[model samples]
Target: MIALDIENVTKSFGGVRALTGVTLSLNEGERLVLLGPNGAGKTTLFHSISGNILASSGRISLFGDDITQLPPDARARLGLARTFQITNLFAQLTVLENILLAVCGAQKLTFKFVRPLDRYDDIQKRARALLEEWNLVDAADRLVRNLSYGEQRQVEVVMALSGEPRILLLDEPTAGLSPAETLRVMEMVRKLPRDMTIVMIEHDMDVAFEIADRIAVMHQGRVIAEGDEAAIRGNQQVSDIYLGVE
Candidate 1:
């Protein structure tokens, strides 16, 4: 079944066309990786899909519901989650506290200022479980600012997952990392339940090919080619535009 769809999507910023007439669909539980060189408009499409930015024109739907005009938080509440290219975390907050906040937000309890901390014991337990699930228990008490760049990225991912989203859009998930750190993140992604649909913008070919069941290649604000990994690898246009193999 199709879990997400983007139809006739277009976005422009002033005179620059970030995306032009892009369309794509993802099956439930499919792992799709968006690939492109710089200026390919991969991030723009991600923003449109995740509702971080409005599409200049098009329709976006999740599991058969139109959400093109929804805000980020509303889309998030609709079982869509995303992670930015940069780490978005509470730097001054401890890992556990940050996780608790995510859990609270997921449960819509963050606005209940009158509620006592004791009232959120279940959320606290779930937060600890997430920390343990990601092997972050050792650093749970440490401030996010004290964590390494790779660790911060890992935490950012877990935070996104805290909501148990049915569809997750990740932007440059392995963007800045040592080879080892990249591998670690890939392993984590690989172990996730297959019931969750994943769409990620990735520059790291190894990680992309390793995790993506389908690959979509973009160039100059358009998707140039999309297919299975083998098809993408042999497509001359993709190799020419992205790999620069003349």
Candidate 2:
């Protein structure tokens, strides 16, 4: 089953084109890694798919239903969730609080603006389960700002999963971590259920190769090559533009 279908998607900022005629698709439960240099429009493509920014042209569908015109929240409701390249968290809130908010937002549960979230037993149970499953229970009460950078990153991933999304878009989840931290994030990703589809933007070649069932290499503003590790490793253009020849 195809979970996502992006066809000829294009995005432009005035005269500058960020994504040009980009087309891609993902099967249910597949993991896809997007590889590109700094100006390769990888993030722009993410924004277009997640509806952070609308495509200048083209079609996007989720599970055979056209979602090109849906808003981000609507997309989220349709089992789509995404994390940004940068950490987008409530720094002032405790880790548990952040996860609670995510669950609340995802389920669209109604609560008074100032009411305590603990009032919802189901929400609290869901949040705690995520923390325990992610091995983040120890830091659940700590402020997000107080946790280490790597810990914070892990929390972000857990929060994204709180909604139990079918399609998760992760943008540079390991962007600024040390080797150890990177490994930790990798483990968290590996532990996720095999049936959830994931599309990630990663600059780390090793991580990309290790996690991706398939890879799409972008250059300038388009995907120039896409295939399994062996195919991308053998592509001369991919080597010249993104991955250097060994």
Candidate 3:
């Protein structure tokens, strides 16, 4: 089944086009990567899909249901979750607390103030399990502000996964990581459930080739080439335009 469908999508800001007639479909459990140089509209495409930025033209559907007009929060409620290119966390909150907040947000309990957060034992249990799975249990009590850059990124990912999203959109998830840290993050990403659709924007060819079942190369706001990793690597157009290979 198709997890996400983008057809004829286009976006422009004040006469400057960021994306033009972009189209793609991601199947359930598919691990796809978007490859592009800087300014290639990779992030813009992610925003369009996640509803952070609305597409000026074209249709977006999740699991066969059109969500082109839905707001970002609404899309989140519909099983769409995304992590930003930069880490986003509640700096003042503990790692566990950050995950808890994400749980509350996903459950639409943001308005419930009278109830003690501890009232959700099941939620806490699940959050703890996620922390442990992501190797952040040891740092769960630490304030996000105090954790190392890589650790902070792990927390952000845990928070994104806390929602149990059906479709996961990760924007440059391995950005700012050292080579070792980048490999670690990619390993965790590879461990995600096979039923969840994942689409990530990555500039690291090694990382993208390692984890992506398929690759889509974006250049100047359009998909110039897309195929399995081997095919993409071999494509002359992809090599010349994006990979900078002769």
Q: Whose lDDT is greatest here?
A: 2
**Candidate 3, residues 79-149: lDDT per residue as tens digits?**
88999987788899999999988886776623444456555876788788888888888898999899888
lDDT-superior candidate, 2 or 3 = 2
Scored by lDDT, model 3 comes in at: 0.87
RMSD of model 2, in Å? 2.8
Q: Per-residue alpha-carbon lDDT of model 1 for 115-191, expressed as tens digits?
A: 56765876888899999899999999999999988888889889999888999888987787898888888888888
Stretches > 4 Å off in candidate 2: 109-119, 243-246
The Cα local distance difference test for each model comes to 0.88, 0.90, 0.87
Q: Compared to the true structure, candidate 3 yields what TM-score?
A: 0.93
User: How do the predictions measure up, each by TM-score?
Assistant: 0.94, 0.94, 0.93
Assess candidate 1 and give its lDDT: 0.88
lDDT of 2 by residue, 6-82 (tens): 99999999999999999999999999999999989999999988889999999999988899988888788778888
The 10-residue segment of model 3 with minimum total lDDT is: 109-118
RMSD of each: 2.1, 2.8, 2.4
Quote model 2's TM-score: 0.94
Candidate number that wins on TM-score, 2 or 3: 2
Q: Model 3 segments beyond 4 Å from truth?
A: 109-119, 243-246
